[model samples]
Target: MINAQAANPFGEQSKLLETVAAWTLGLLWVLPLLYAIWTAFHPAEFATRFSLTAPLSLQNFVNAWHAAPFPRYFLNTFLLVTMILAAQIVLSTMAAYAFARYQFRGSNLMFMLVLMQLMVMPDILIVENYNTMNLLSLRDTILAIGLPYFASAFGIFLLRQTFKTVPRELDEAATVEGASALQTLWKVYVPLAKPIYLAFGLVSVSTHWNNFLWPLIVTNSVESRPLTVGLQVFSSTDQGVDWSIITAATLMTSAPLLLAFLLFQRQFVQSFMRAGIR
Candidate 1:
């Protein structure tokens, strides 16, 4: 009883410390976003000024929208993400299934090679990818932006792990019912790994949607530029920095992803949980 009573104070102190630390970190993380929000909605003079009675207007957003080819950028980003996701899903599913189900010669070596890709940063391969795009005559196109990412090492690794967890009996049963290899994969394995698929799809969409450097290097025109690249070009100018307009533009470009995360946050969490993704 004495020991329990003595530990209670220490435990309370630890919890209090933890609570303070958490709020401190949370505030730090949110400070920039809060500043952006304030700047985006208020006039240029009031951007740095924190006034409770500051007038909010939508003029910044209007000016930002008219200042760039945001509509074309949006279209390009949408098409890029859609193309990359579809290709990744199909290719990753097939590759993962092959690696998980088949025991062929050098299968382990091949899988190791795939995993090696995860260790190497994509930025490191920029020169080679750019050369390949040039050789293929696909530069300054959406295809060039997505070609290097069509086969995702992370997607394959994730799906392989998910597929390995499925029972062998399901595969056998599908085969016994006169299902071909492709049919078995489609019917039995794919449905069981839906959570992983959802998780991967969301990750892929967000990553490609926000990809800037590669797209910036490959695309030269507004028609081929994604939102990230477009926003970058729009923000940098000979004129002085306009925080209100820049923040408004930043918010506009990121609004889709932010909205998606907010709306599907529960499902996103659940999908990652079910997929055992950390």
Candidate 2:
């Protein structure tokens, strides 16, 4: 009886420690966001100082909205994300279906090379990609930004795992019904893997929306630059640093992803969990 009581106390202590760690990590992540909110709303005079008595104003947002072509930036980002996602879904789905269902010579080896991209992203190959883009004359184009990410190893891997989890009985049934291979995939496997698709899509949207380095490298003109790159123009040496305005711009750039996560917080969490399971 004494040993049982001691073990119970040890388990309780472990749970308490886990709870404390969770709270600590949560606060660490949230503090910067809270600080940014405070800074973004504060006036220029109060930007650097933390003041509870400071009046909140929409003036920073108003100034940021007027100072930059934020609408155009939003549209550009939205379009680029949509374009890349659409292409990725098609290409990755097909690649995943082939990788999951078909047995070809050296297929596993080829898939390994594709998965290697998850370890070394296109960012690490920027110089080579830039040269390729130059050869294709796609510099300063949205396509240049979207092209490299169209075939995503992560997406393929996620979908392949999900597809494999689906019962082979369905495939055999479709085959018995005289459905072709493409029909079996479209009608059978795709619907079953919907959760994985949603998870990958959410991840893709979030990543591409916040992507700066690749966009900055490929785009020079305002016509093709994403919000991250556009925000840089204001903070660059030529323009000089305006702390309040820069914070305001940073908030503007982050708003879409912030709003998206808020709106789909439950689904996003569940999707990530599902993706991890897959």
Candidate 3:
């Protein structure tokens, strides 16, 4: 490998170029976050100015906390994500088990329809969803915000693939030991798909946690609003834009996910790798 690389200057140059490009893109992505952190910790007058002598204070965070009903938003967001994750896991697991294990009429067609949902963007269904919510009298509620996402095609597909990789021998043994279908599934399939569940749950939680548009359209009050929508309201001209306070609020809203990813990053990567391999 060393001799081959030594003989290929172009390949070495390409590798170096790729490394530089990756770093450049990473820096670009982190730039806004860096700026937010800087401004959030500094006074408003120093928001646009860079000074080594600048004082760091927690006053901006204090003010941001009080400037909006952030506690309510936080509670709402936590509940929304939890509700969505639980529903997705339960529904997807059952659907995936059926698709992976059962040979039934129209199963392929049904699975294909689910796969098609992966291509159809949720934004395209906004108007229809709103009408549905209004018809069902669930509009402007947390349940309304989560109802559309309960049946996740992605989650179904991921779990289906994972379940299909389980050993048939284990499944048969469980059955022979007097386990019912549901019991076998609970003991065998679900446990084996734990990594995939973790991966899917993480994905679902993060996606809904950052979701803005659907919640904004569905929710009309602070009682139902998630952090993203609440943040938009906080930063709107009606609230008077204070960069310091706004950035502080932004960080607060995002802090949970950031911390979660940072802590479980290893598990996050490993779970997906396992899911992909299976």
lDDT of 1 at 115: 98
As a whole number from 0 to 100, the lDDT of residue 144 in candidate 3 is 99
The TM-score values for the models, in the order shown, are 0.93, 0.93, 0.95
Candidate that scores best on TM-score? 3
Global Cα RMSD, each model: 2.0, 1.9, 1.7
Candidate 2 lDDT, tens digit per residue, 148-235?
8888999998888777777888989999999999999999998877767777888899999989999999998878877878887567
Residues 1-278, candidate 1, lDDT per residue (tens digit)?
58875868789788889999999999999999999999999999998789999999999999999999888989999999999999999999999999999999999999999999999999999999999999999999999999999999999988898888888998889888999999999998999888788778888999999999999999898879899998875567888789999999999988898888888777778877866753
- Listed per model in order, the count of residue pairs whose N, CA or C atoms clash below 3 Å is 0, 0, 0
Compute the lDDT for candidate 2: 0.86
Clashing pairs in 1: none
List the lowest-lDDT window of 10 residues for candidate 2.
233-242
TM value for model 2: 0.93
- Put the candidates in TM-score order, highest first: 3, 1, 2
User: Per-residue lDDT tens digits of candidate 3, residues 1-278?
Assistant: 47987788799789999999999999999999999999999999999999999999999999888878999999999999999999999999999999999999999999999999999999999999999999999998999999999999999999999889888899889988999999998989998888788778778999999999999899899899999998875567774678998899999999988998898888889988887886
lDDT of each: 0.91, 0.86, 0.92
What order do candidates take by lDDT, descending? 3, 1, 2
Query: Which 10-residue window in model 1 sums to the lowest lDDT?
Result: 269-278
> Which is the better candidate, 2 or 3, if ranked by TM-score?
3
> In angstroms, how far off is 99's CA in candidate 3?
0.8
